[model samples]
Target: MAKVSVDRPVAPSAHPPPSRIGLVGFTTMFVIGTDTFLVAPLLPDLTRSFGVSTEVSGWMVSGYALGYALLALVAGPLSDRRDRRRVLLSGLLAFSAATALCGCATGFWSMVAFRFLAGAAAAFVSPQIWASIPALVPPGRIVRTMGLATAGLSTAQCAGIPLGGWLATVSWRLSFWTVGAVALVVWLVLLRMFPSVPAAPGAAGGLRATPRLYAAILGRRRLALFLLGYFVFQAGNLGSFSFVGTWLTRDFGLSTGSLSAAMVALGAGNVGGSLLTGRVAGRFGPRRALLLGLAVSVALFCALPFAPNLATALVLLSLIVGGVGFMFPVVMTLLQQEAGDARGTVASLANAVMYGGTTVGAALCGLLITGLDGFYGVAGFTVVTLLTSTAVFAASGLFRADPATA
Candidate 1:
């Protein structure tokens, strides 16, 4: 068994403050999340530089999501048996290294290979953050702390890729190198700040967790369907946003600077939505919160194509992105509640499904965007994605108040 210093259990008195722990984890996680969106800005550059078709170039985005999805399934269980700090650090280091490899790539396949590795590294990091929070935070503060963590992720999504976009305008390679450096700095901070905890006995016993866990999760039919529906929703959300920078530049004729500014606006909105989601869920229940959030998202995506100008587009996009803040945390809290004791395993499973949806969306959207270059084409696709996802959730019967709850 691999015992890790960071994974070792500690007495409550020795634990760091929840805010600090969340801050450290958030910083690292933001960097990881940034990696997922980083490829967006560089998509056009990649196509031209590598002399590949747009569809092929999109593998740079889809490949990462696919790799992350596969690894997340495994990383969740491994984190249970190993030190979360070590798992997190290792993932960061790998992400940095792989990103650098992407920066230095001489060919398309080489870039894709490094991207796949980068995604794999990213996969391990998310589970640790989810698993570590409950262990590190007080019960009363967990929701807020998780909200903070979600806020950071939202910032990364809305801000990180734009930074990469701006850097790509300077030199695409510079963007990758810069992010790699940032990841290194976060790794050091995590090492110094976070307390280490040991992996659970189940993970250490070399036990096969996937089949058993899936069986258990599936037995709860409602939970299983909800998770699947959530996966579809996530795929649509990521697919649309992952390449929004590219879309804006191509469709609206916005400069990189303007796009970056718009992204920051989107992040600001996300911060507000994320901050309030926990409160709303606590008061109204996760199901109601989810329904409202998804409805908001559906409306936004529907209106996005019709926005007449850059300013109008930005306003709509910000609300759409910001509104998403409510969906994820609510789902996470529900998953944790549903898991009862096996929180780590459940978190990992839910995350895997979410990213699996992301993978599917990225790849499918990549295909959709090829040869059809206009606002209407992308908008039509996004509307279909949103509507289909919404319909799935509405019909799934997972959004009802659990009778046992109150």
Candidate 2:
């Protein structure tokens, strides 16, 4: 029996610098990230356009998450056996086309179908970026590079939603078209600037071998616990977030402009957390940083429902999102490290878990919101999930010693 080698060829030092690659990756992710959350603010417009209730209209959001989750399991492993650059470029091209079709959708079902396709395309794109980061940089800079990539995501959350909301005021279709156009431009830039990232030499078995790889990785108790913890955490975080537009409009009667402004504040908190995540993880260690973020999130989730006005709600919600911003980079870095040579498969599965949680949470929120005290019910659900995640994290034993200082 031959021992499988775990090593892959690193990026050439003389080619595209890591900083340039990081910037391109960040831009690509920013477009993808913006598309993910852009729909939140457009829920009202969609409801009006489709002549459906907000609860039913919410399925469009869930559709994207569901598609992304299912396809990611396949995409990750497939990328591990092919050229990552080709996979990424192909995904980006499909994403742009799907997004444009979404903008042209004439009804609810059509919109949902296009959104799902868009997400499926994106499933192939994002994991490549995550897998490439580890290959593109030295071990010491991986977390920092991850931080930059995550920051792109956070910045999109902060700025893209507001931009989308502003565009939706003119026409909901405009937002989708805008996103599609940006994606096309980014695809071109990436095609020109991105370096080739070959698949791991020993990971050529593709989909047939993915299940065994996942089984082996999940056999590690600590890694399994970490993934489970992330699932629970995202369920709580996204459950409440998915309904913010409805809550704001129905409860406070805020217009699109006002809602966009409020979301900008929330996004700013995320940006701050993303930018600081590397330093935070380095200083306190990933375990402590994750725990602290969860604690902050739980406290904020509990307090958000009590806010007397929109101003108070925005502040509390921003802080809660900030906790999410802080947690993502740390957890992602840990997951990537655990994957060894199977980075693409691991990263994709991790993303799948995250979005799978979103799908469940968003669908559940849709059901809950149909009842009285819907927003409060959602908030309660968030707190419970956060607490559960905290418990799982504590019990995982991954934090027995700080990874940074060890």
Candidate 3:
């Protein structure tokens, strides 16, 4: 396969310029991120539409994560063995189709099935974008590029819920349809603008080779430790976030409109953090940035239960989300560097670990919330999980600064 160079500026360049590639990646992630987050806000509409209870409708969200987590393990290694462009395009097309099908679902189970399929297809798409960044940009710019991509995802998380809620006022299906259309546009842009990235030299072995490849990647102590830390980190972040609406409504007696407004603050902080992460990581080094963010996040989690009113809780939550935002690109860059030749596989596993963490954290919080303190139990869970993550990072000895770059 011919190599496509990405180092040049966008003046009739043979390779797509880095900026264009970044745009495609950001747009793709924004669509997928929006889809992932939009479901939570639409649960009430879905429950009414399908004639199901809220608890049962909640499966739509869980099912998406479940499918994405399981399939990401498979998609990651498979992309390593093929042209990443092919895997990404194929996944996007399938994801778009599945999302459109979701809008057409006549019952709850059908919606769940389509959501699961959409998530599975999406698992194949995002890891390629993550793995390709190191290949596409100079090392100095890689983290910044990652920050851009992370910002797109973070922005989606910030906007998706409220956007979905507003759209639900019109019709819940409109959000799905809109996402599908946006995905299709992104798919076309990717096909036109994405530079061709060939498979790794030894990566083209068939499905039978997957097990050995994954085993080899997982056997690396640094990679394993980092992944463990990532899982714990996400569990804490998502576990608390998963119940934010419930907490606001139940504890503070905030209405839906007020809750949405509060989430905007949280989302804005996340976007700001993402945009700032590259500079922060560059100055302090990824390890220090990671540690600092983790420390601040833990402090915020501990303080959340004591917030005096709705406004105070929102401010605290924003800061907490911002800390997680700062950590996002730093951890991703570290993981990609550690993965070496198996970056695609490692990227996939990282995503899987995130979803698994969210699932586990949410489940634990659910159990905890049934106690006397309710949301306070969730807050305590966040602190404990974050502390565990910090311990893993410290013990791994991989927390040293990277060599200073220009």
TM-score: which candidate is best?
Answer: 2
Off by over 4 Å in 1: 1-10, 201-204, 207-209, 371-373, 394-396, 402-406
- Error at 384, model 3, angstroms: 1.0
lDDT to native, each model? 0.75, 0.83, 0.77
Report the lDDT tens digits of candidate 2 across residue range 1-406.
2221232556466445768877987898899999999888888778888998867877888888888999998898788787889999999999999998889999999998998999899999999999887777776676667777888899898998899899988988999999999999999999998878776566446356767766777887888898898888887778668888888888888898888888899899999888778788778888778888888887887888788988888888788778888888888877766666677878888989888888888887877776756378788888899999888877888566775542
By TM-score, the candidates rank as 2, 1, 3
Q: Can you give the TM-score per candidate against the true fold?
A: 0.90, 0.95, 0.90
Per-residue alpha-carbon lDDT of model 1 for 177-271, expressed as tens digits? 99999999888888889778666554433545555655766677667766777787777787767667667877777776666676778777777
> What is the model-wide C-alpha lDDT for candidate 1?
0.75
lDDT of 3 by residue, 176-255 (tens): 98888888999998989887677745444666777777777777777788789888988778766766766676678765
Q: Is candidate 1 or 3 superior in lDDT? A: 3
Q: Which runs in model 2 stand beyond 4 Å of their true positions?
A: 1-7, 404-406
Return the top candidate by lDDT. 2
Weakest ten-residue segment in model 1 by summed lDDT: 1-10
